[model samples]
Target: MKLKLRVIFFLIFCLPGLAILGYSAKLAAAAHGLTSTGLTANGTIVDHERQTRRRVGQWYCPIVEFFHQGASYRFTDNDDCKQSRHDAPTGSRVEVVFDPAQPSRARVDSFRGLYGTSLLSAAIGLPWLLLGIALVVRVR
Candidate 1:
């Protein structure tokens, strides 16, 4: 196949899959960071299988509500807290960082947590993407 065709095919198939993975990761990470308190009322626990360990893993995620720039926003861990550590007890108050311009943008701890989640999704998606590319190359 021509390079243009390969690129087009890759974008048509791989991009959607990767985009879904990436956006979901971003949302999960955003929600995970929003929770300022430990797992409890607004928080949730997700049981998901780990890609690396191939084992069922549990993650404690929190729901945080905060006010920034004269507006209030809320979010939850959803699925991004897979490997995050629980540092405080339930109801323990914690500082949450959020974008003042965008109150919905928040994090329970470090920004790295979200980045890690996104990276994890990319890592998981890369092999299939590469496999498709390989098949295209081989057929070509």
Candidate 2:
């Protein structure tokens, strides 16, 4: 019983914690310039939407050249606009941040932060964690 409980506990906590840790590591990597190109993109709002607070999708933004390491970094807005009704002009500027290691893996600057995405993951993950704990306790 003790071993079972221990395994259950580890599975419940470690898995979620690892997920959060991995996400944090990814963000830290971006912040520390572990990627290839640190480029900023000038985006034109090809489209827009404003329905509920839910995210729809992302489109292309724009690109700008900036100097990072010893070379000039070229950033591009490769995000597909969230599905919405708010219309953005074709030439609207959309801020884009890129992964230095993988320049191709780019996204809008506004969407790069870790807080909101972390929260969303936690909101969905915590419940399952709690349920696992509850089950373990009950079974014992």
Candidate 3:
């Protein structure tokens, strides 16, 4: 009975961790591809917004505006993957990398901006995965 329970718990924890790892891998690959084949543009930090979370403190998300193909595009760096919320200040200039076919799909041209989410996800998921594996091995 204990072994069965351990197995069940292992599956419950391991499956989500594996899924997160897969998703993070996909995100990292897409970011790498975009960085390699995207066009560069100058972007301006227009504003900053504070995103509040239940348990976590407020996060500062930057609103950046840039031009592509003579049209203006605005992007918000609001994803929770960044280690720091205060990455950019208002009125600062940043380099943006955008897809030529779809300018709306863009990211700040930096290592953290491009792949921070995936790296963060991997960092979190890997430990869960290892714990799951250890639980399963102990069950045997």
Candidate 2 residue lDDT tens string, 1-140: 77787687768765775566566556555544522355665544443333333364444333434333455544443333334324435445656556656655555556443134545555666665666666656664
lDDT of 3 by residue, 68-126 (tens): 87899998876523335455667889899999998889888888888889999999889
Question: Model 2 residue 11 lDDT?
Answer: 87
Residues 1-140, model 1: lDDT tens digits:
47777787677657766775777577665556554423222222222222343375655455656655555566664434445445433454545555555556555554554466666666767665676666567656
Which lDDT values do the candidates have, in the order given? 0.54, 0.51, 0.83
Candidate 2: residue 119 lDDT (0-100): 52
Ranking by TM-score: 3, 1, 2
Steric clash count of candidate 3: 0
Select the stronger candidate by TM-score from 1 and 3: 3
Candidate 3 residue pairs that clash: none
- The alpha-carbon lDDT assigned to residue 108 of candidate 3 equals 86
Work out the TM-score per prediction.
0.47, 0.47, 0.85
